[model samples]
Target chain A: MKLFQDKISSAASRVRIALALKGLDVEREAIGILGPDALNRKPEYLQLNPQGLVPALLTDEGVLLTQSLAIIEYLDERYPEPPLLPGKLEDRAFARTVALAIAADIHPLLPPRVTAHLGMIGVKAEDIAEWSRHWIRVGLTAVEELLARRQTGQYVAGDAPSMADICLFPQAINAERAGLPLDQWPRIAAVVARLREIPAFADNGPAPRS
Target chain B: MKLFQDKISSAASRVRIALALKGLDVEREAIGILGPDALNRKPEYLQLNPQGLVPALLTDEGVLLTQSLAIIEYLDERYPEPPLLPGKLEDRAFARTVALAIAADIHPLLPPRVTAHLGMIGVKAEDIAEWSRHWIRVGLTAVEELLARRQTGQYVAGDAPSMADICLFPQAINAERAGLPLDQWPRIAAVVARLREIPAFADNGPAPRS
Candidate 1:
């Protein structure tokens, strides 16, 4: 299996964490997106991911999986040794809810491309920072609320670190990068504290791009 | 089950279409979001959906499922009459990849709240339109490329209408709403045309608020 990834990307990091948790060995090719950005848009790379989004996984069967959640879930399904999603239906729903809360709400806002577009469209650089911080805070607040729910365990959704934690830990890392304080969202902070101590999350996360 | 939704929301409409396709009767409540900012921020509604996004489903089991993909997948798993995900594993990945093309990429860009934020941050109204049109075109262009691939079926991933069609149809609708011509994406237009003919897509979609 091959993963085309950006070392610091929350989406890519989410998948990296999953591969770690699942104990899947894969090759990683760093696609230089933080630079001028057309590296991902080239014909060959675009063929792998039409959207040109980073962290696409090419399975050994030759099928390409995009979207962090889809790839993570695919890995969990294929390797089923440790389930990243909860067993019960409601628990699964909550786990997905929390995962998407970060994946959709927080990460999209702070992506370099989005921020660059904001600058092009006349948003001041300082205001763009404000925008990123605001949305990150909003997303983390929601994460806090969800984490505080009765379903909460040591991780975000259940006893084991599930897909919810896989997605959230990366967003929390990005939130700190965006200068949003995690201390305000104590439950979210608590969950991240627990997740960071785990080997899978700690070993394969947000390392400088090589 | 009940769905809290906005009549014209692309994400909400995606879930509504899935519910219809699944032959599940659902009570729909129009959440007034276009008027005031953050109707989704209400304490009552936020209790059910902390992220304040619409199309949250309250199952008879009293579980709240947010995020259109999460809700749709939960319903599909529970009902299992007509599967929305393909039977083959690789085919399922493609279905989800297409869904996220719209869900994660397109819909987040055109949402009212995001545009409103742009306006507040000094992006001209016309510039916001330009921004929306630009991103919608980017997303649909990506969709067109993926649809044009060899895996092309009458629907997105295969012969049957799946979650890809559910997410894609609403996005096609929203692209038009953003004032971008859909003709440039002929393959996408053709697939959406086929899916719209189905009873579920025809029966329940972005009808004006009651």
Candidate 2:
């Protein structure tokens, strides 16, 4: 497999973590999503991924996959040894619920393109920061509350790290980066700390954007 | 099964379509997400769903499911006569990719909370409309291009209305609501027209916000 990704993309980070958890090796191609030579804007990359986003995976069968959650799900299904999703139907739903809470509700609001759009719309930088922090706080607080209500083990869903934890780690990093520390959500902070102990999650921390 | 939802919620509409497709019936409870009498803001509703989002499902097994996609997946698993996802792994991934492109990327930007935040930050109503239209255009155009590249048969993924179509219908409605017509994406418009013929998709169209 060949993966097209940017270092700082949280979505891509999720896929990278999944690959590592699956113990699979793939050729990595770094794509610039920022600056003058942004590869995601290039015609070739756009042709491969119409969304022109980072973290597209080309399977050995030559199928091109976009959308990080979809790619991670593909990986989990294709390589099912250490499944990213839980075995039980209800547990899996809970895991995905937590994942979507971050992916759909929180992370989308704070991406570079979104903040840049806010800037273009004449939103002050401070307000944009506040906007990012506000969603992060609201979303993460909900996740923390959800976790508190559940009988959580080491991870978001159960004893093992599942899709929920995969989604959580990146957004927690996003929170810290946005100046909203994980201290606000102690359960999330503890779960993230446990995730950091794993090499797959630890090694794939978001790299500095070039 | 019991579902907590609002008539105008696109997310809830996705679940409604899924349930209808599966030929299942659920008890529905109306929850206001907007205005002063918003049920989602009430202590009881928030206790039930910390995210305070619509389309939460309580299953026969007494499991509480949040997140529309997750709930749909659970329903598909627990009642598998007709799967919402495609059979093949790659095809299933593609279906989910299309779903998340809208679920995680486009729809999040147009929700009432998001637009309200923009307004609170002093964006004019016209600008907010443009903002909604801008994301709808960009995201749906990408879906159009993706469908154009594939051998789509009546739907976004295939002849069957999978998860992809479930997501597309509501978002296309959103595009129309934002004053951006579907004439811009012929393929999506065609698919949506076909989806409208199905009572599952047609009847669950975002009801007028009460």
Candidate 3:
């Protein structure tokens, strides 16, 4: 079993946190996703993950899993100890909503926004950042409302650290790094503060972009 | 089960197709996501889906499920006869690779690109369209490569339709509606052609923007 790629990938970090929670150990190979090493570009790596994305988890059964949510869900399904998803079906969906709010909505917008920042081509950095903030604000505002509905708790989904917390912590870090202020969403700020206190989260930390 | 207000919502359409596949009857309410139906504006819808996106499925148990992929997966899990995800665990992951390529990569860029075309905002329409095309082209190119590697009959995974096909068919219809060209990816084009013949896909159709 192997987790191929780097410490800096949001997707990779997600797997790491989940695996730690499950107490499962897989061989870790920190291959560079970009540049000369470009593990994602290698024929063998591409075979494992055709999309050429990072944090591709090769399961003990030798099945390579792409997409953070899918991989995480598979792990939770296979290993029930210290479950990541909530117990009830509705609660599970709610956790998924919080997770997707960041994974699908906030995560995708970051790259183009950053690419625009490089200004290597004609795309303006400010425009990209503006686009990034627009989506982040939209998603985070919704997350704030979600957290508000749940009683004052330790994580995004009630007291326990569920998939919602796992998905959100990294995105919150990324949003902070992107210079998007969280002053507007106090509930989210509270959640982030709580998540930061966890040892696993602090250990995984945010990746330093190349 | 009721599908919350959406006269013309692609997400809603996708779920409608899932229900049809299961032969389950569901009542529909057109809350009009973009209009002043107030469902999307009210706290109720916000509670259901923090993203404020359309096609929030109100289950028989009254749980509101959001995020089309997540909702669809739930449906597939519940109704296993006409499976959405097919083949072994590895093959299922491959199918998810195709699904994410459309859902996360291609779909996210569409709204901004389409709005960019309207020229109502100051942001360059051409730039937005270029960004849309760039992401779509990259996604489709990957799909094309995946197909080139293994395609048994008409469908993506094997002879039968899977979640990957379900996701791709809808997006293909959407891209065509948006006037995006498909000459570049023949394998994808072929798959789309084959999927259109399926009853489940044909009946749901693309939701028209009201």
Candidate 4:
């Protein structure tokens, strides 16, 4: 198995943590997305992922998985020893709700395209920052609501580290990188710090790409 | 079970068909998204779905599942008499590959905010059209590639009305709504047309909501 990844990508980091949690050994290659190589746009890489996106995993059976969520689910299914999801259906649903909150709402707005496009629309940088802060706050508020309803365990899904924790960690890392205010989102920030203390999450995360 | 949905959204329509296929009775409320009683912005609705998005499901057990894909999967699991996923894992992954191509990628880019924001940037409408078409063509090409590899049957999966068909039906309808040329995407169009012939895909679909 092999993984074509970007060290700085939140999506790639999600999968890296999964692999580490699962104890799977995948041949890893880091593609410098912004450098001269432009490896992600290369023909060979595009063949692996038509979307030309990072964090494409090549399974030993030769199937390539694209979406980070799908790939992580696949990993969990194939290796169920240390599960990434809760057992009960409702618990699974709760965990997925938290994950999708990040994937669908928060992450989509983070890419530079969103802010850069707003800049072209006569929206000032301050306006963009406010918009970013507003949405992140909305997402964190929803996450807080979810957390409040659950038992305060060691992880997002009860005491075990599940997919919800996997999803939240990267977004928290990116939120700090984006300079979104963390003071107001203490519950979420606390979860972030808690996740980092776990060896699997801390060790598997990608080193900063220079 | 009940579905809170609007008549115009393809995402909502996709869930409608899933419910219809499962032969489940769901209390249907047609929300007027632009009216005085817009269900989406209501505090109660927001409490149920903090994302303030449409197509939120109130399951029989009273749990609210917000994301469309997540809702569909929950229904599939709870009502397994008629499966909405393929038998094999590879085929299931292929179904998801097709589904997310539209759900995550194409549908997101086609939203009005995306084009309107681009228009604000002095981007020509033609360029925005080209950009929309670029993603459409790319996504369709990947679907075609997956189709070419799989055995042709009644649907994107073996011979069943699975999530892939459920996802594609709405997306193809939305593509037409977006006015993208279909001639260049014959295989995808063929699958779209074939799936529509099934009553579950046709009758339950969102009629063009302009």
Candidate 5:
């Protein structure tokens, strides 16, 4: 197995955390996503993943999987020792609801590509920052309420760190990067603090592109 | 079962299609999403779903499932008669990848809330329209390429209309609403045409709020 990834991508980081938790090993290749040498835009990489996004997983059978949530689900099913979701059906749905809220609602608004597009269309930098901060606050506040309403244990979904935490850890990091105080969502802060103590998540924090 | 939904929501429509495909019956409640009576923001509705989003599913067990993809997944797992995902693991992953690409990547950018944020930040109406069109085109173009490379049958993932088609159909409707020519991505256009023949997909087309 191999993973095409960029170190700075939160989406890629979600998969990295999953791989660690599952104790699965895969060859890693970093694909540049910024600047003139952005390899993700090249013909060869485009052939591999037409989305030009990082974190595409090449399975042993040579099937390529894109989308961080999809890749992580593939991993959980393929290696079920440490399940990323809870056992009960309702719990599983709750875990996924949190994951989708972050992956779909919040993170997409703050990605570099989206911000860059805003810039191209003449959105000033300060306004863009405000835009990022606004969404981070709105989305996380909802998540904070969700955790308070549904949390059964130390984590977002239950006693263990499941798919919800896998999504939350990275998004909390993103909120901090955007200059929002993590404590604004205390439940999220506590959960993220707990998650950081786990090596799988700690090791995957945003790093300088190598 | 009961569904809290707004007729015009594409996200809500995704769940509606899944419910129809699964042959399940549920009581329906239309929650206003626009105008002064926006019930989604009402205290009771927010208590049901802190995110205040439409298309929340109240299960027989009284577990309220939010997020269209998550709710559909829960339905698929609970009622396995007409499987919404494929049987094979790889095919399942592929199906989810296409679903996520639309649910997470494309749909979020075009939603009313996001566009409202852009307007609040001083993006001109024309620029906002361009923004909507640009993202719809970029995202569907990627979906088009992905389908060309991986489609094994008439549907997005297989001969059967699975989760991929469920996500695709409403998104295709959303694209058409944005005034971009659907034929710009011929593969998507074709798959959507095929999907429309299914009553599950056709019945869920965007409707005016009653």
Candidate 6:
């Protein structure tokens, strides 16, 4: 099994944290998603992941799978020793739903493609950053409200960090990087702080964007 | 089971198709996601789903679940006889990856929040529409490339429609509704045409945006 990842990728980092939490070892290669190597844009890489996105996991069966959530869920299902999803059906649904809040709603908006589009349309870099800040704050605010509910505990789901925490931690790092203050959401700040201390989540720290 | 959905919601339409495919008899409540009813914005609705998004499904166990894809996956998992995901682990991952290309990459940008943000910044309606069209086309182009690969069958994955088809069909409808042309991606257009002919996907047609 092998995983092609760019350390700086928000989606790739989610996979790294989940792998660490699961204590699963696989061959890892850091490929540039957008720079000189830009391996992700190559035809060969595109053959594996047609979307040309970072973090494509080739399972033991040799099937190349794209999508961070899908790959992480695959890992969890394959290696059940430390399941990332809750055992109870409802709890599992909750974990996944909140995870989607970040993965689906927030992260996609801040990718290079969107930023590049903003630039092409004459949006200044600072203005682009402002745009990022706005979307990140709005998405995180939704997460904060969800976390304020009784369902969120030490982690985003139960005592343990499930898919919810795995997905949220990277985005929280992104929020901080984008200069969006987290003070507005104390509950989220608390959860992120706790998550950062975990060896699994911390081992694959967010790589500074070059 | 009860589902709170908006007729015009792309995400909600995904669940509607999936539920119909599973043949689950779910009680439906049509809530305005944008107008005065904007049930998703109400405090009571927020209590049920902190994200305040449409298509929140309350399970028989009374657990409220959000995120259209998550809700559909839950339905698929619970009702496994006619699985929305492939039986093979690898196949399931592929289906999910293509599905995320739409759910994560495409759908979020066209949501009211993003468009509303554009308007807040003095972006004209035409500019916003152009922005939405550009993103949708880029995302669909990626999907089209993936579908062009030999791996894709009659549907996005196999002959029968899986999660990938279910998610892609709704977004294709949205693209067309938004005045984006699909001729550029013949493979995707063909698959979408086949999917729309299916009873499950056809039952919930796209409602004109108010």
- lDDT for each residue of candidate 3 in A23-91, tens digit (9 for 90 to 100): 887788775665534644578777666767776787777656667777777777778888997776667
Question: Best to worst by TM-score, what's the order?
Answer: 2, 5, 1, 6, 4, 3
What is the C-alpha local distance difference test score of candidate 3? Answer: 0.70
Cα lDDT computed for each candidate against the true fold = 0.81, 0.88, 0.70, 0.73, 0.88, 0.82
DockQ score for candidate 2? 0.85
Model 5 regions more than 4 Å off: A36-42, A208-210, B36-41, B208-210
Tens digit of per-residue lDDT, candidate 3, span B111-151: 53234422433546565556556666777787787677655
Q: For each candidate, what TM-score against the reference?
A: 0.94, 0.97, 0.85, 0.86, 0.96, 0.92
lDDT per residue for candidate 2 within B18-119, as digits (tens), equals 999999999999888887446545688777776677989988887788899999989998899788988888889999999999999899998888998899
lDDT of 4 by residue, A28-84 (tens): 887655543465457877665655676778887888777787788778878897998
Over 4 Å off in model 2, which ranges?
A36-41, B36-42
| Docking class for candidate 4 | acceptable
Candidate 6: what lDDT?
A: 0.82
Those runs of model 3 whose alpha carbons end farther than 4 Å from true positions after fitting are: A33-50, A112-121, A150-153, A181-183, B5-8, B33-51, B77-81, B112-121, B149-154, B180-183, B208-210
User: Model 6: runs farther than 4 Å from truth?
Assistant: A34-44, A150-152, B35-43, B150-152
Name the lDDT value of residue A34 in candidate 6.
64
Model 5, span A110-158: residue lDDT tens = 7778888999999999999898899889889989988888899999999
Flag clash pairs in model 4: none
Sliding window of 10 residues with minimal summed lDDT for model 5 chain A: A34-43
Residues B39-94, candidate 1: write the lDDT tens digits: 74567887666566788898998877888888888888888978999988778878
lDDT of 5 by residue, B34-58 (tens): 7644654578877777677888999
